[model samples]
Target: MRTSYFICGIYVLMDLASSDERSFRIYFDEFSIKYKVPDIFEKMDSTLVQLNNRSYINAEMILKRDVADLNVRAIMEFWKPKAQTNMKLYDVRVDGCNLLQSINKNKLFNFYVKSFKKHANVILKCPLKANFSYKMVDWFLDENDLPLFVPLGTFRTITEYFTQKRLAIRVLVHGKVLPKS
Candidate 1:
């Protein structure tokens, strides 16, 4: 028997070794890819930006870093009294290391925003590919949460991260299993 699995917006292929010879099997929930965005982007002026949607990330080296232990800094942009902008910097330790899984699902969004607010004053650099500029700052949890900051009216560039699609999975058994030694 052979089985394939997909979880959390990632395509995962799982093959069962026949040596076990266990007839029974088990499966988990339907996996998905979901995350939070900073409240700043909610503003009308902070239009949706696409990061690496059309083009691929081309780089010689991809570095990894931890977000919890980074020195961060943010610059405040004052335009309108009602609508202000803040550009904070964060240093991600590891890139492409399943950031979504790092945070506990119940408090995932809250944890990220809190991290931004706490570390809003340090020059943070990207841990992954440098050319791939589009990155996530914070995830908003409640309606009361407002924009911490916004960027200038004209953004130099924008990147759209895409949602991973769920692929069809089918499992079948070729033959029955016999007792093991």
Candidate 2:
């Protein structure tokens, strides 16, 4: 079996692990934030950092007031050269409080948490305290723990957070999965 495949002349994707393409990796290409209630943000930033000879995203978000009654909706889309448009891969909306307490109900969400758990000090529960900093230090996708088969491509996630049904913040993350070579 082929170890990897070239698709649409756009990217090379590794075959399943049963093959010899075990060096496929995931990396963040960009991180961005949009504040709906700009005044509510005390500080928010995301940047790339090198640690242990690998790259990671260091992100932090701090609010000016205690945040509660939060809801979250996230959509993940993929861009394939052949499609010429984004294709929705997954979409989920959850009550922030419930999600923190019962992430196991959503395998995708649980997987996300696991990927960042090692390097993040972000609170897992709701009602984020005012002036308290939430952080992800030297956080990168844990390829070894991926729960789904991610094809090689440019992927984007739009994450929106709401308080009392009103949009408070938004996060846009771009990432890519490719052959390590």
TM-score for each of the candidates = 0.18, 0.78
Query: Candidate 2, residues 1-181: lDDT per residue as tens digits?
Result: 2434335222423445334434567767777777788667899888876565355888888989888788999999998646688889889898888888887786878878776677879656777888988898878776666635656778899999998678988988887777666
The residue pairs that clash in candidate 2, if any, are: none
Candidate 1 error regions (>4 Å): 1-69, 81-143, 147-181
Best by TM-score: 2
Q: How high is the CA lDDT of each candidate model?
A: 0.25, 0.77
- Tens digits of lDDT, candidate 1, 14-132: 22222223332211112122222322122111112223221111112112222222221212122322345623232122221244334344242445445444433322332322222
Candidate 2: list runs displaced more than 4 Å.
Answer: 1-21, 50-54, 147-149
How many Å off is the CA of 108 in candidate 2?
1.7
